[model samples]
Target: MNGVELVCPAGSLPALRAAVDNGADAVYLGFRDGTNARNFPGLNFDQRGAREGIRYAHERGAKVLLALNTYPQPQTWSRWTRAVDQAAELGVDALILADAGLMRYAARTHPGLRLHLSVQGSATSAEAIAFYREQFGIQRVVLPRVLSAQQVRRVVAQTDVEVEVFAFGSLCVMVEGRCYLSSYVTGESPNTCGACSPARAVQWSEGAAGREVRLNGVLIDVFGAHEPAGYPVLCKGRFRVEGRLGYAMEEPTSLSVLDILPELLEMGVSAIKVEGRQRSPAYVAQVTRVLRQALDACHADPAGFAPREEWVAALQRVAEGHTHTLGALERQWQ
Candidate 1:
């Protein structure tokens, strides 16, 4: 419970400020390029914006984590290295990286700079984390959203590397660093291009069949007359399966670990991440506030901790599909 940072997402300068102002202990953000994931239109930070954000976050005693989470092509490898240099120059508190080469470059070039393993690194076990920690001096690792609470606890028990788990925002059923549905349809995926279902390929149309969305001309979902549309990703798309239209891969939902705050604290979890950089600043502010409140309550009295109704309601307001899950973090039956 002590020194457990609330790591919130900041896709833009506005979101960064909102997260910091809302009691976030740290904020993770990406550059406006392929070097980091969550590269979307009108999103991410430019050099100037990153410097300002660093200042804003530092002034409030909050750390700023620069994400260099995407893999690199041989021809475009310098882009990732340059981002690492710029992050160090701009005074980022740490670098969240997935690529081994990038992590090595950062560790070698700026030995004092802290390194964190991004969830995209796919380090599910302590052995994998130990490799990064021993090779590149990664001080922390963001666990992918695939581990049950028991599994995560086991990993933590085996590794000294700080653990950061996603506590809120969208669900990725495919697991981080490996999902290829976007590339299968759009030729670009978060792994290299830093965007899934890249905005350029997303098509929305109104027709007699209520509404429909497509990615790269492939039909993804057809909405009902009164149904709400979610993110234009194929994973959550409702499709005709066995003669009935339903979600086959995964449903549209967000992950919330409100019910397991005490368990996380008990496991010596170093951080809890909020996973929305594509969302608005309002979303960041609201989620950060609710999580901040919940963390404070849990830390105050872990044995007596219980998520407040209002806090849960506040999180649902910004949750995908207007609902939330404990995600892989819950496995009481197991």
Candidate 2:
């Protein structure tokens, strides 16, 4: 466990600056359009924003990785292509890409640009990583958050490309984010639209001593008077599984790996990515700063590493729920 880079998320220009200011080794963001993953309202960088963000990060001794992670539609190839060209021209440290055609184009057009395989491609195994590396000259691969620390070590041993794993943030339980559950119910594709349950699809109806949460005309969840209601996505619904109503996809839990950083670093992971580009700038700043401090302490003495419980607790305050799981860090958590 020599040193592990902190790869954070930046949804907007202010968030980008916050991430760098708080000690993110690298920050990944998407464009304002659907070309990037977090293509929601009031998020992502425009062309001017991206240029300034790159400049800001570089000045602060941090790198900016542009995320062109979404797959392009047949008629939308030109939009995605131009984004790749602009990201390279703006001198992003690397381009996190998923589209094969765009990767090939970048490899040819901008020969010096560094390419990283995105988890959206669902490349969990070493063979898939190798295929991208061999074909498009990918230098790093953000492995899907579906492998345990031991499995990460196996991947590291098998691939020449540097491995990056998500260590914290939203625990997306839908098979490395190959999720169509929400789109099926809400008619908005998260993969292309960057919105899971589109704001327009959700409705709250008062029920008997509770509320009925609906999505796209379907009943998602019913919250009792004492029960705290959450964002009613279909997957998080309490369904009848094995004759009992309980969470099926997963109970809403943020992934926390502050205590398992040593295992990831020992597994030879090049970087630990913190997911949540949709979060606020304050969220970005606090998480980056605390994680950096924790990583610093761990690097100083691995055995002496004691996670800052207050910081971890602060995270829960901003978290979507009270639950936190080491998503994929332990295989059973999957």
Candidate 3:
């Protein structure tokens, strides 16, 4: 990293301010419609809200990146294109897009606007990144949470475009663009519908078994009196494998790269991004403050950069399942 940039999530105006005020280099957010991935109820910004958020970020010397990251269906092509125009008109610092068609539209129509390839695009290879940089002149690419630190170094060494990786937040087991387990259960996918497990389809009730949660009438999880109920996403749900009920797919855990911040910066990662856009402003504020302190500490003493126990504990407190990992950034089995 030439300069350490901490990119935070902002699902709302207050979240945006929280990030900027806490020393975030940039805050990424989406509109109130299907244009962004975190399109849940009571989240995202309208035009007026986007403008206000952008102003607040700029005034604080931070950047506001607009996420128009969902794919545009044939029936909704104009809607996606119009969103690109709106982001430009609203003066967002950059446009984070995924679909090649949308990226082309942004490149040709709003050539001057900075474009970041969303992690949904899954450009983990240097060749994939090169194609985007050559075709649309994308300034940066947000890598999916599937690459190790050495892998990140390889991609950075080969590509001219900037690279951003998730530093803290929810850990997904698959490349975001390809995950369809949720769609199989809920008929909605975050890549297109802007929600992994859309809130509208979730059903919860107290039963003699303690509690049960379902998505689109599909049983996702059943919790006993002592078991904590995780989110209703199918991938993170408990399942029966070999007659043993457990996390057959993936566990409820968060990704925290605090242990490897020095390695990431040393590898020349252009930015570190936090991954909670659907969380509360308080979540945004807390995570931002922690990452800011850690990043500053790294700069103040690069050779002495070691993750503080308190930082790990603070992030773990809000982590999914109250646990954290380096994700695929470091595979212990390897």
Once fitted onto the true fold, the runs of candidate 3 whose alpha carbons sit more than 4 angstroms away are none
- The sequence of per-residue lDDT tens digits that candidate 1 reaches over residues 40-125 is 98889999999999999999999999999999989999888899999999999999999888888889999999999999999999
Where model 1 places Cα greater than 4 Å from the true spot, the runs are 332-334
> Model 1 reaches what TM-score against the true structure?
0.97
Candidates' lDDT values, in order? 0.91, 0.84, 0.90
Q: Which ten residues in a row have the lowest lDDT in candidate 2?
A: 187-196
Q: 114-211 in candidate 2: lDDT tens per residue?
A: 99988887888889888888888899998887778788899998998999988778877766448888778876766766677776788999987589
Deviation from native of the Cα of residue 296 in model 3, angstroms: 0.9
Consecutive 10-residue window with the lowest summed lDDT within model 3: 325-334
Q: Give a tens-digit lDDT track for model 3, residues 1-334.
A: 3488999999999999999998899999999998888888999999899899999999988998999888889998999999999999998889999999999999999889999999999899999999999999999999998888789899999988999999999988888787887788888888778889888899999888778999999878899999878788778988888999988877888989998898888888899999999998899999999999999999788899988888888899889889988878886612
Q: TM-score for model 2?
A: 0.95
Query: What CA root-mean-square deviation does each model show from the true structure?
Result: 1.5, 1.8, 1.3
Q: Which scores higher on TM-score, 1 or 2? A: 1
Clash numbers, per candidate: 0, 0, 1
Error of 2 at 298 (Å): 1.2
- In candidate 2, how many Å is residue 133 off? 0.4
